[model samples]
Target: MSERKYQPTWDSIVTHPTPKWFRDAKFGIYTHWGPYSVPAWGENTTWYSYAMYREADENNNPAYHHHLREYGHPSEHGYTEFLPEFTGEKFDADEWAEIFAGSGAKFAGPCAIHHDGYALWDSKVNHRNSMNFGPGRNFVAEQEKAFRAKGLKFATTFHHAFNWFWFPVWNKEMDCGKPENQGPGKFYPKFHEEHAMPDKEYHEWWLGQTKEIIDQYAPDLIWFDFGVFSLMEKYRKEFMSYYYSKEAEWNKEVIVTFKEIAVGQMLGNKSTQFTFAPGTGIMDYEKGKLNNLTDNMWITDTTIDSRSGWGYVRESGYKSPERLIHNLVDRVSKNGSLLLNVGPRPDGSIPEEAQYCLNEMGKWLE
Candidate 1:
């Protein structure tokens, strides 16, 4: 077996006390909004983006044909091409925040960017952004304004690194894994070639984008989904410095929720170690939810329905309101937070099922 990767030992922020605001306020809101949502409802994710590069002609799921017919192939219409459809006109940030407050959310956050590489805020790094193209509005700033107005903490989740790699199939110009080698999508003229990976240019682009969002929104918390430790040390340091500097300016403390087994020394302990960081917490990915309470505080993020994908899907079935409330009570009793998700449609409207769930949750909170 190959050697294990190095895990950085970077320490958690100890300059200030773990903010009382976040500790008291449990639960938040997160949305997986992007070009994927533009299609409004599909099977969980933009799998076609990666399946186009797979070796086997057959995909793990046979949904590609449906996706192609639904949203033309990459050649004719690249994922980014759908940016025009992501209009948040229907998105009422203040109203959403108010609903969160009513639902007993301590803070509110948006998927600043998802696995689709589209930043919710205006980004100078990549042209594909909510401010400039998708929503054509400063969604992050709007979210911050609305949530802060309600005295709720502000947070942002970054899933850009995953997207940077996830979408390369589009750039690779590979066929739909067909040995016969079909033609490229309309926008992607090249077919059956190596896809371009993010190089130094992409790295610089990511940094610039990250910096822009941080400076513009000044989120009280920045949650990185996966690539935190894999990031270059210099970039990691810079990110930490920027985050700390920003928090200092606001006269507040900021928290970064990270997991162990990442490239760097995990600020938090592994599930085995139970060495969770202070103010920092744990998140039970899809299958795992904390059952037994730990002396440490943690958060469990689960979907309303295990069957439905995280992003909004039209035919999706959601969990009952009772189950959701049960989940919240269970987690809180264990000293954990519940971060619920509402997969908004491409037009920036919450789906009926998600809203229904939230409304039910609101009733329970009241």
Candidate 2:
């Protein structure tokens, strides 16, 4: 076993190299299945719940009108109401893993938590999780087990770090203001201008939820959404240090990925103060493809939905399998990996269009 010594400082983490497996494993699958998939009407993202709450003209806002016609007003039928309806009755982790494995994906997993603040795992820190509230199933653990059983690297994506600020509209009188409906405050936390930056309590909660996931699933790859740059410096350092240390103890080479904002420079200074230093982990481009090859290893995350959305839509315009396969070839030629996303319906069934794409990719690979 190699000596395990990694301090939390940037100087220490910067010395860590990208895992060899990730560099070689050029294809992976990421799923965006959660409460948002219930609504599933966004353009290319899964922010319909939050976007519907915005006060926009009905003529210009389809999401808002759709919400009103289908589920009533946001005040009467808030996003939380979707929880009870999100009973993943058809969810089969083993089957989903088999599809990913058949797709020639070297790794696969779920977006464990999106900006909606609903955790897919059985989380003790946050009460509003899949295990306790929606599906009554530890989806994260199931995927991890199934993926590993299929000899695929297990990964998990976290977007909850931004939930604190993502749903500011929920704090309004028309949303979670009514006495009977104030309960969502636990999930959609009230945010004011003064509370722009998350306070100590929120930071602690973020750290706790992250630690819980790490402890429970031991995901081989942990991916963070863009808002991680807003996290407090100490909390960020603590997470990286703890994750690196834990991987060292397990005698495994794991990966931690972040968006450009988390690692990019801002206003002439380094973002996160180099907390997520270069060479410490992989850099991910969301729904973006690099134009040219680079010396550094990177990954592109795009959706198979021709509509470009990452969640399930009633009519998800799926891209052709040939296009996706060509993208995989292009990415691999440039020393990059592709993390393709598929959104499942509320009942946990993968769309046939997505299945078709995956099957075509499998044939091409063979």
Best by TM-score: 2
Superposition error at 62 for model 2 (Å): 3.1
lDDT string for model 2 (1-366, tens) is: 134466777787677778888888999999998888877776844888767777688777778888888888887788888877677899899999899999999999999988878889888888778877767899999889989999999998988887777665435555654444434435455444535677787788888988898898888898888777677777887788788778766788888988857334643565455436667788888877788889998898989998778988887688899899999999998888999999998999998889999999999998
Candidate 2 TM-score versus the reference: 0.92
Model 2 lDDT on a 0 to 1 scale = 0.81
TM-score, structure 1 vs. true: 0.79
Model 1 spans > 4 angstroms off:
1-17, 46-48, 51-59, 169-198, 259-287, 305-308
Candidate closest to the true structure, highest lDDT: 2
Per-residue lDDT of candidate 1, residues 126-186 (tens digit): 6666665555787888889999999888888776665545644444343322333222222
Error of 2 at 187 (Å): 4.3
lDDT of 1: 0.62
lDDT of 1 at 86: 66
